[model samples]
Target: MEIDKVKDPATVKLHSQVEMGSMELKSILGYDDQGLVAAPEKKSSDEAPLKVLYSSGSGSFNRKVMRNTVVHSIRTVVFSSRLNLLMPFGPLAILVQTLTGHHGWVFLLSLLGIIPLAERLGYATEQLACYTGPTVGGLLNATFGNATELIISIYALRNGMIRVVQQSLLGSILSNMLLVLGCAFFAGGLVFSKRPQVFNKPTAAVNSGLLLMAVMGLLLPALLHTTHTELHFGKSALALSRFTSCIMLVAYASYLFFQLKSQRSLYVPVDEGEEIHSDASDDDEEVPEISKWESIIWLTILTAWISILSEYLVNAIEGASVALNIPVAFISVILLPIVGNAAEHAGAVMFAMKDKLDITLGVAIGSSTQISMFGIPFCVMVGWIMGVPMDLNFQLFETATLFITVLVVAFMLQEGTSNYFKGIMLILCYIIVAASFFVHIDPTAIQDKPPETKE
Candidate 1:
């Protein structure tokens, strides 16, 4: 029994293991030559507890996979960028909550708007990368791009946030022309030392449509300001907005029809240099059918989340505006919209760096298309359901600025290839618009129509 007790587990396992003599064992055990000794056993309190890092007991393996994946560095950059872009929306909800009491929850409903928008943009981005003409598919993407911003405007309209709606509209148009396009042009110029090319005939048609719509965006307000007749449409009457936008809508639709009909010959031929040559010997086959369904499911799920998040963002934005005392209009129009388009902005910058000129151009121009085609219509329809009409008209000062920006962008995009000089001109055009807005030109002066514009 004395020998067996001494031969038990090592006293200090971490240190070197040693074979001890009987004398040492006797000393440690406090036993000698066939004598019994009472020895104290180690207590649980004296030992270090075991540490466990991973356990499968809590939840799904998929979540664990995601958690492990997040540790990689590259995904970290993209994720951080996306999150930074999304932060403004959370504050937006607080702003809404501040503006209204519990009624603010209704605004949360607008998140449903995020899905169609993302789907449209993702599709457009992919299509444009292939040097494809701005097809119906591409146009659909353009529509979605403006989705969240448009939805927020509708929600604000439902709440009778006239000032917010108009301001956000102003913000979207001006930001695209100035901040969005300006940033794109400037960055592309600096990074690649390349220029913005005009898209001649077909691209020109699209530019013309854009410029016309922008002008209409301004004219709606000017016409309303002067006529003072609130145009209504039955229970769902066409407001002054719809009538003015109708002209623009007709013009764009016609332009689209003409371009698509002649697309093969007119738009820079799609298959020129972009055709990829794949080797027959390569083992990678066309993707399996499961991949398609997976993409669709992911797309649907992501869209749903975006809409939910957008609703949260709109409310937070309203709350933040009240808290900050900054013009909610400015925040909605400029800051918030930018947050929503952070993905496109990143896409634009990446394409510029790689010098993918046509896709870069499409990203810039297509963004505006998304805002005009998708954003405006969505706002109008949603606003109506809520019983508050969204007006697209502008005062003379704003109208004039929009008119000028239109001419500049159109002229720049008239031919297909681009370089930095044209990009500078575009930036310069944006600067004039910014200055005019900053100065808050009197409505009277702009209405007076300086002799030059009148002639």
Candidate 2:
């Protein structure tokens, strides 16, 4: 329909910001067409009156386009604002972490520690959380993660700083064995009365077996070297130990290989409502992959910051006790790792809340692996660079605590089932370990031992 009004030379942009709806864009005319441009206001075609009162200029189609444009722009701005906060700090913190090794203590503060390690494990699992059909990727992501963490840890172990490596190893193990698994059992059991959901048989079986092996692997060296670790292994023993670790390593490799195969061949039907995390779901959106370059850059920076600040951390502790009046033991054992791990820990808990059991498990385990691998090795590498031989290793108690924790966790998660009872067991185990740290418990004195117990 054509209008009789003359064209107005002045057309000012007038934007209507609507609440709970898309904004509308209109052009205000100066003189010739001052009133609203009407497109033959028609009564409802079917006489429905209360819905849309009237239709105006160019019908509903033109208004929709304008409305859509405004809405998209508004949403873009809103989303970008949140991303803006992490844009600088997240990457920058990671970069600062990778470069300086102010000693292995950097592992705690440095976000780059795991980010780069995750990228380096590229031949294996990926960074992105897939959100699509089939559980192929999701299954692989979960099961194969152990291999990736092991690869990273091996690199860290070989680099040295036996203590730092050991400490980080202990840290990672405890976090997973106690914290992650415990949370899963606790949360899952608490939420529902039925037994916690289990994964496929083959995958669960392999995972349980590998976890048991890991427990054995960590314990072997400690037990063997308890007498004289300084007596570095001869060629034969070294070869044998390496060969053993290698065989254990091969088991993990087998697990990964089998997982990949299963990913292709197997098609176990998931719960109709079973949300395949990282495999497209109704609840959560997909995880954007971290870029390789960003991973590399941040890892370097994070290393540097951590290394540099460690001396400060050690130095500051002296004054911290004086100022804060906190005990040295509490500050050393609890506060430091907690502070350094704040980010990663949050990441783990977040995964749990999302019901990404695999990720929550992986992060806790990967962290220990990172601490053992990158954290320890980085410290050793830095020490070598500086020509300073640092005595960076954990105490016997720490290692024992970690070993015991993993042992118990392996037993609990062995059946691929978790519940409140299992969670309680984990928590109880953690408590026992903590108490052992403070009090003395000599098993040799009591000749009583439970089955599957850590000797």
Candidate 3:
């Protein structure tokens, strides 16, 4: 009887089992899928060995697939080289959460998964940059790469986790300036230990100035609220925060204008020695060039998935925090920023590996600048619109940390030279900040009204 005509459940089951068994046998015998079906009917014992394509068309196609398989296999062997191999673990984490209602494990796995996804987002932005010029590319990467932090903060704000939102924002700044930049410098030093890594001094100076401007912007409100004690203090502080946010938005626009137009030359790389290669392509791998539209599509898809994962990650926050007995403020300030800016960490490291201090510096400084100039202000506006009304009056410790970070990084990069010890010193500063937060962060310091829920 023809298998196609078989309608009996027993017969269908038998056939399916037989087919699966045959496929399994072909797999055990070491034959390709195409050979499985074709071998029985057409392949002869004497037939010419399946010629591996070494040319264009079918041969090239087969070779490409073979090469990719071999490369991936090798990458698995070299764990440090192919961190993106962990990309598969992302979906696996989602599955784990779905199968077992364990928010703790889900949070852990999701955190692990987010690291590679964020890195890929940065990679996608780089591929997108090949098609779009520096201006658009920088904008795209900044908005999308930082999307993780922004989305996570928004979710936190909606849940009335105002402390997390504020802490995470400030933490991201420190992570970028201190942690990420520190790692970059360290990596650069490793590669070019004999010589100092030099980048565009002028560009670094401008970024430093802008970061200082943002630091001052944050400082004013903290100072005002601290110095003045009144019955309407909360209202005054809120009003001052909103006004500062508006001014920041304007300042951000001017920064963009400066980067894109008036001071664009400072950013343009002249030679390999002087140029900071914007992650146009992965130096270690043959990353396929993607179209602009496809890049956007993937960017959107990745950003959406990141949002979902972030929710799960954040949902488990309380559980994890309680289980670990860590302060919520510490998690928000240290761990959350690390999770959110995982891409920057990896990107900065990648450039540092290539000894491109300029790009490494750019990624670190650029990210902090964006968060200060754009992200904070945007979140403040969103909070107000949602009736949550987040303010910029960060804890004195947080404000002081920002000041120190900006001061130290600015001084370090002022001469456009970097060394291993410098990187170590910067990292030590971050470590000190993290340790302090772990010991003293008070989640209850900021009193925020709960976000209203719909009936």
Candidate maximizing TM-score: 3
Q: After superposing candidate 2, which stretches have Cα over 4 Å from the reference?
A: 1-127, 131-161, 191-195, 200-202, 227-251, 262-348, 354-400, 438-455
- What digit string (tens of lDDT, one per residue) describes model 1 on residues 1-455? 77766755455442334435656876665665656533332222223231112343435656776676545422333243343354344445445556764423423423323323443335334433333333432343344445556666766676676655665665566666555565665666676463332333466456557657666665756665666555542222246566655665666667677656755456543332223424442223222212333334443544555555665666555544444433344455555655566445555555544444445545556666655654565566566667665656555555666566667777666665555566666667656655545445333322222322434
lDDT of predicted model 3: 0.76
Candidate ranking under lDDT, highest first, comes to 3, 1, 2
Q: Cα-based RMSD of the predictions, in order?
A: 18.0, 16.1, 17.6
Query: Which candidate would rank higher by lDDT, 2 or 3?
Result: 3
What is the lDDT for 127 in model 3? 62
Against the reference, the lDDT scores of all candidates come to 0.52, 0.43, 0.76
lDDT by residue (1-455, candidate 2, tens digit) is: 12322322222112222411231222221112334333333232333443333443445766787688656543432243332343243344345446653322333333333333222222122233343222333433332333322333333344442333344345444655576556656765676445464533444344545555655554555455555543554333333344455465456556546645646344343343255343556433444334334333433443444343333444344344344444334334444444344334444444444444455445554444434433333444444455433222243565566556656655665575555787778767766654553343223221122221432
